[model samples]
Target: MTFSPRRPLTAVLLAGALLAGTAGCSTFSDSGRSKYAQGEGKPAEDDDASASASSSAEAELPYDIRPLLHPDKKYYGLAAKGAPASMKSVKEFASSTGKKPNMIEFYSAWGDSYETTLAQNAWDYGALPFIAWEPFKRSLAGIAAGKDDAYIASYARSVKTLNQPVAISFAHEMNGFWYSWGTKKATPKEFVRAFRHVHDVFEKVGATQVIWVWSPNVINPMPKVRLEPYWPGDSYVDWVGVVGYYARTGPSTFPTLYGPTMDQIRAFTKKPFIVAETAAEAGDRKPADIKDLFQGVEKRDDVLGHVWFNFDKEADWRISSGPASARTYREQSRSSRYGFDVTKP
Candidate 1:
């Protein structure tokens, strides 16, 4: 979903509850917002038992995910209306495309705790949970100055306790002017500082399970904005997520839409790329655009995969928007190289 100035009441209330809860515990008073509004973990046992259980769970799951970091196959992902929160969107996407997504993308505002249920559910369904962490409530300067350390540390600790591999795209699309952390609102230096600070906090908490994805909107629309200044360096990121769309007026082909951005990014870093957000607009060109998108990722060795923005927000971006588009998506997405059981790498 694109950035909107209007905040959701459900998300606001959820964040408020999280802020009011105890910071030291993994369990939150609320389950956060979800499509079906499911509960999170079971009631906490004694503090010692909870810690022991968390340790055992962490031991059961391997912390070293370097092997899966750069897999041979490209990952297919989806960002639907109610994603990681519930598998309903993913299941519907799978039914339409004939292949379940290897990565499930969702959005979370600042001050919200980690969605443990979402992570666990995605893992159980054989997909990796990808979070677009938006810092809507605070300024990048404030975050970099350690004003939000309490919340950041709390969130990092919760992630560590879960001990699941998660892909986080923090303050995404900073190169754009759409969000609070965007070009008009925050400087590039402040953005980089805040990004590195967040990464360091996660490191301090031993949340090595996270795959830090530094995402920026495709530079096609904003040719004047440079990406290097916003970059948090290679060590601070695991993947470069490029966000773009195939709209009716702008660049339609992959070369014009994402190629330039990828080219610019390559000048600075050789990190693997993921089309973090993309979808063709609903119209006569939708089917062809879908074909181009799948082919574009398939032919590239550096592009690890793509995450289709499956919502109908400004335009009908869903694959099932039309019969032709639906058929084309299912046909083009049938490539054996698209998805895999994330757990098995």
Candidate 2:
């Protein structure tokens, strides 16, 4: 999801200059290697843990598909029971459209208020579980900050109770200026420390029922120099997820938005990668744009899935829901961009 213009504007202006200097290499010595290691343990250990987790990592759906946030607007408390026709349609499409189960993102705050609604709906709908939980927002803000300790603990318990394999994404988008985690003047080391600290807490608490997801924005449009300080070591992250989107205000093509960051992070880590959140505006966003985004990176074996940012605010000026988006997506199936036919490729 794109951040409000108020904060990201400055980041955008600085991107070009930063890209030019990515050529000069920076050393990640003491800060990157020490301190945080004490609390989170050695990166080697985390790496081995992640590797073992991968060997037996629960098998993913045959074709990658995450429905993003709840389709039923009701979960947002914006619709009454059975009122979101669009969401309902998308749910049916995902379940019946293919043989495999489709995944969906479950935002953390929403969990407190809408878990029952989502759980009930998820059970009935046959939506594959790719649960994406964001607990870091409240925690880092000092709002939740481990106080209830029992709160996230309870949330983890609730998720585990669901008995579905899920991916818990805490404080994602760490590499971008939009989120609170990345907003401060944090060096990569500091970011790494903060990231590991949170994960360590989860591990200490015994929340292994879920997979750990470390997601960051594709290379910030800002230059490389400014971006280097954000690379927390590759060891701590289990699955590498990236948020990439196409909008009129930004780059014209999907690949332009996703390519560089996808390539860079892929080079840095061996973990499975996901286009965690992605979409193109409906009207202004040609079906071709969606195809292009996937087309560019479809070949990467490391690339595992694509979760559309089915939010309504960032529209293509035409469609307001997933049904319309899916139609446009299928209509353009003849193109190379439509490489996700579950039956074949």
Q: Model 2: how far is 301 from its true place, Å?
A: 1.7
The clash count of every prediction, one per candidate, is 0, 9
Output the number of the lDDT-best candidate: 1
| Per-residue accuracy of model 2 over 117-140 as CA lDDT, tens digit each | 564354334333344444433435
Who wins the TM-score comparison? 1
At residue 163, candidate 1 shows an lDDT of 69
Model 2 bad stretches (over 4 Å): 2-89, 92-101, 110-120, 130-148, 185-190, 224-235, 317-327, 331-345
In candidate 1, position 256 carries an lDDT of: 82
Clashes of 1: 0
Q: What root-mean-square deviation over C-alphas does model 1 reach?
A: 10.4
lDDT of 1: 0.79
